[model samples]
Target: MTASPTAIDPAVTGRAAALDWVELSGYPTRRNEAWRYAPHKKLAELSFGPPVALTTSVPDLGDLIPALDGPRIVVVNGVVNTELSTMTGPTGLHLSSLLDARREQPDRLAVHFDRVKSQISDAYMALNIAFGGDGAVVRVDAGATLEVPIHIVDVEVPDETRNASCTGVVIELGAGSSATVVETRIGVGADFGGSNIRTTITIADDASLEHVLLQNVPASHMHLSNIDVTQGANSKFLARSFNLGASYGRVAYRVDLAGSRAHADLSGLFFGFGDQVLDQQINVVHSAKNCTSRQTYRGVLDDASTGIFNGGIDVLPGADGTDAEQSNKNLILSDRAEVNTQPRLEILADEVACKHGATVGQLDESAMYYMRSRGIPAVEARRLLINGFADQVVDEVSIESVRTWINQRLGHDDV
Candidate 1:
């Protein structure tokens, strides 16, 4: 028998009530503006049974991404696997499993757990919070600066039957602290499954955080992710994402600048091939004065794949001196490929400066011909032009190992 949406699972804690609340709304349909481009038919047809106990062994992730000189936390099947993790770091850095935090640091968990739940009405996010299992909890003490990056790896072990996996991550940066966090999602097997993930971040006054999210799961899987961030006064948040895998993937980001002089920079690159579909949505809210935000996204589609980009910026009535800009550009490599982009801006403050634009088109034939006339082969010329277009976002990645991995994926490592 198929499991009901309100059924409670033993693996998750304090989520049965949330599950029941989400059941009323059910799944999203094409009528929902945020889910218009999503593959609702395929997602709705699948019947995922109740959440199963995470009994699979942790897969070796050493070969997935290049090794970096920092601490690593690994999660397999939505559960933390300490046997495969290296959590040693600076004196002020603390890394532990969410389950452990709930047991030993209940006070801290109580302060942030489900705090943003009421603010978010998205069905997928509600479902994630209702069923998510243990994830990583990372905290940096005040005035501490970590010299190395922290990596969190989430992997799915293929199951013969349809199932669901959910994970929740909480990150807090204390006042005057700074750190870099990298998250990677990957899976195996050829069977269809669902992966739901959510991450909430809080940056205190004068703190800074550089976050990188990479999704490269199997082509037979469907992935949904949500990232919500809150910034304090004079804080900085930089986000970079790369989506190059998954049969149908959707990622949404909500950033709120609640403090004066805060800044946010968001950029991403997505490549789709075969019959895959990728969608990226971003919403930035300026609620304080003297804040700034910038967003730039680029996509490349080949074969019969489709890509979508929707970004919006909003300035509140009191958010004077707000500066925001958004731009999205897509390159189509085949006649069968398709792309849709929408950029929106709502300015209620008279002193705000905001602009938004989007463009979808084929590669520059003139540039391709110019490279070919210089004695380059057609294939090489095409690759060179694509690489040049993608480098605009890839170059902004600050971490060396991540930069190298992205370059290798784009076939620009050697060049």
Candidate 2:
């Protein structure tokens, strides 16, 4: 007699071993330091089951690509969809799929993939590595300057059968090279049936990379993303992230300046409405001399939504003459809305300049009253003031179209 679905005994196979680790690492309480503040009880308890076979072909690339010019890579459900992406550069700039790269350059992939060694003791990170399916592989040539940006879109399509954890992406920039990357996530409706995604990036000596992350996933779905990067000598990296969707979402980022004269600028904006819960954690590590880093994050919390921000900077013992600063400012638009902001700095070096501070409050009563007294309505005045407060960080984004989109979403365009 044929065995029933549940009658089949559980077997530990190749990928099953990895899934076991993922499940164990996702436990809410013990052995998972990365999930300390942002527990995955809701996401972990749900039975996503096994990843099913890929059925749908690659989606159209027309809407995914930005209007501007640059290279492009499209990853759907954590797997690279080659038909939807573009790569522009000389032969030295290797833009290939993760599977192709793994087959061709196993040694390089082994060294660069999941090489971030930190004591955060994050179990999810290892789980991500072990279960990573396929992702984009971008390797810039030494001294090559990618004049335009690289747009990477990781979209989650609604599924009728199983929920999947999509692919991951890993990028490596060679010495003296430069590139910009834009990552966007899209989901339809309030369906809790989609994919979870995680990604990582690395920058080499004298390399520079600017990364923009946009999240507008389904309101009912859940996404937990983690990104880690390393900057070499004279390398510079800028990260601008926007969180706007999902009932529960959290993104953790870590950047290490391991070479002299490296620099990093990390900034983020989050909008929490409804019962959404969004959390962001960032860690900047300065391991060499003459490194500089800056971080700024702002958020708008409405309804009963809650947001959390924890920014940390660590200057190692031998790292001298470092300059670092971190700031987090939040605005609560409703009485029940809540925001938790924490900015911290740990420096062991004797010679350095660093500062960290955070503030959480509502709209200024005096300013609001003054605007109301002038002829502006209460809603308009509040919107104007809030937009102005967040404008400084938005202005730092290099992409004009993205900036415009962000502004429009924040209701600042009309104001």
Candidate 3:
């Protein structure tokens, strides 16, 4: 069952405003346009228990996650582990939690929470706010650079089917500052267990942030997440995501370019096998002048799996000089594999340049034959072709260590 108001009162949910949405309208269903392709029967079969504090008994992180070049924030179960996190980060970088922010930066936290809460639009987000325990707050001061990328590693142990993990993260970058944040998530068990995470980001004027997300859960677990980003004037926000494994996974994104000359770039790859189903909903709004946004997502489906990409770019009135591009291409490897893609554009502004395209196809037999003629086996040729299709997204990671780690995970790295 979903997190209804009857399951837990909104009064005791958190310190913010009461989450009355559940009481107004129950959980999501197939009728909910965003969840039309989801397996609703299994979603209702899962339940999230109350949040708890994690101890020092962390999982084998080295084996589950990549070895990056920066500080790490470990979230065992659903709470952040201090014993594993680097308390002191690079210059001008600060770390705080929900309790810490409430105790020290109460007004700031309240303002941020208010801004992000109004943008919420789904039941998964409601569940996150109602059941999410102590959340993480990451901030970077103005005019300062974070020396290295900060990694947030979230792991959920296999437990009772009724138990799940819920957490929230808030990232704020001051004006003119720059940093990279990588989120590595794994360990949604094969049982009926699941994970619900919500992250909100704000980039100040002239600031820049590079965000990367990695989701490689089990083959029969539910993984859900929501990301909301607001950009200021001259700000730059880049995102690269890889969704490898999940039985029912939905990654939703809402980006608002609220200032002139702001840019938002998102590139993602999803590879599904077995009976897995992967979906993405990306909505980028251009409410400012001279703004640009781009979305490029690729899907590789094998076995009896399904993939869906529903993306949109909206340019509101008076949002002149808006330039946006969207593309989604899927490679079907098995006869039973399925793919449904939609890339749309809604422009109500002047001097706007918007374009979108979606394609679903199989491997190129000519390329396979060319490779096999050069002493490469047929199986090896197909593998290389798949890697080449995925590299378009991976090559944009920028960070060497993170890119290397991704290559190793995708089995594309040379020994």
Highest-lDDT candidate:
1
lDDT for residue 88 in candidate 1, whole number 0-100: 86
Candidate 2 lDDT over 161-203, as tens digits, reads 4364545677889888988877877654444654555566778
73-132 per-residue lDDT for model 3 (tens digits): 777667677887775688889886654565577577654445344555876677677666
Give per-residue CA lDDT, model 1, range 181-228, as digits (tens): 998888877778767778888899999999998888889988888888
Cα deviation of 137, candidate 1, in Å: 0.7
List candidate 3 segments past 4 Å from native: 1-18, 52-56, 115-118
For each candidate, the alpha-carbon lDDT, in order, equals: 0.81, 0.72, 0.80
Deviation from native of the Cα of residue 89 in model 3, angstroms: 1.0
Off by over 4 Å in 1: 1-14, 45-56, 115-118
Better of 1 and 2 by lDDT: 1
Error of 2 at 112 (Å): 3.5
Query: Each model's RMSD to truth, in Å?
Result: 2.9, 4.8, 3.2
- Candidate 2 residue-wise lDDT at 175: 87
List the candidates ranked by lDDT, beginning with the highest: 1, 3, 2
Once fitted onto the true fold, the runs of candidate 2 whose alpha carbons sit more than 4 angstroms away are: 1-39, 46-66, 88-92, 114-121, 158-162
